[model samples]
Target: MLFTKGGDGKVIPRCRIKPLSAKNVVVEGRDIDVQTFLKVYRQRVHGLRFIFDKNVRRRSDLASEFEGRIVLTLKIASSGEVENVQIKLTTIAENSPFSAINEDVKESVSHWKFPKTKNGATFSFPISFYMMLPQPSMFDDSSSIKNK
Candidate 1:
């Protein structure tokens, strides 16, 4: 919650996310605000974080925790079906756990559906991940996440 002093000097509470607009379609990705994105883009991005976490857990042998990103270009058809998912760039190693993220993303996104458009569209976005995502063990309560 956010609070602001009213004109009468009374504090007014605001909800975490108050919709700024009713439109679901955004002309440019950056033009979409966080509040609007959560309402409109939820269907497009749901479960992606889970996929990244699942892939990262596949490999636990990192000398040190690492932070990286994987940028992808996706093309969708007029019917809203994803035509392709291409890895444009990545800062992570091209090896296990890391590479698995790309593979799974591509496969999963290949089946995603977006809002239909006149000529379809192509968009590029990034997925960032951290290695050795730390969690406290049963034997130690002080364990914490590692960062680069």
Candidate 2:
């Protein structure tokens, strides 16, 4: 049980703030708050993935050989709109050709849609990119010979 200072300066159990209801969901020791948090988290993750995929498709020229992590902080409004977006290139390599990847992700994430809540919230997450290399054609053995 969690305790907090009450209005009268007495330590009160935090759970006293809200009475349990029949509609409240609980799993293990978690209460409605945990369930709500999980729902919101899943929704936000799904939205981010959708936005990332859409933006990646728009930038087909992104280098596939580079691996990097982009950290993004988003301020989401209660109306489910993205209010502000902050991008930090946390794992970019020096003099990399994909220097603009962070900007690209930032621009794409700005259009992300999240579930509206009763109050606005701030969320920060890291997006890691490990692009797959294009497969060489099996019939293109002549290209290898020419290089040798």
Identify the candidate with maximal TM-score.
Answer: 1
Over 4 Å off in model 2, which ranges?
1-64, 93-95, 134-148
- lDDT tens digits, residues 1-148, model 1? 1233447743332212112232422333432333433343355454565565555444434413545666677766777687777888877567545666667777877877665656666666665544332222322536765787
Best by lDDT: 1
Q: Which ten-residue region of model 1 has the weakest summed lDDT?
A: 11-20
Q: Poorest 10 consecutive residues of model 2 by lDDT?
A: 13-22
Taking the tens digit of each residue's C-alpha lDDT, what string does model 2 give over 19-112?
Answer: 2232432222222244443455444454444433444344435624435576667676777677887874467654555455566657766776
State, as a TM-score between 0 and 1, how close model 2 is to the true structure. Answer: 0.49
lDDT of the candidates, in the order given: 0.53, 0.50
The pairs that clash in candidate 1 are: none
* Superposition error at 22 for model 2 (Å): 27
Q: All candidates' TM-scores?
A: 0.56, 0.49
Q: How displaced is residue 137 in candidate 1, in Å?
A: 10
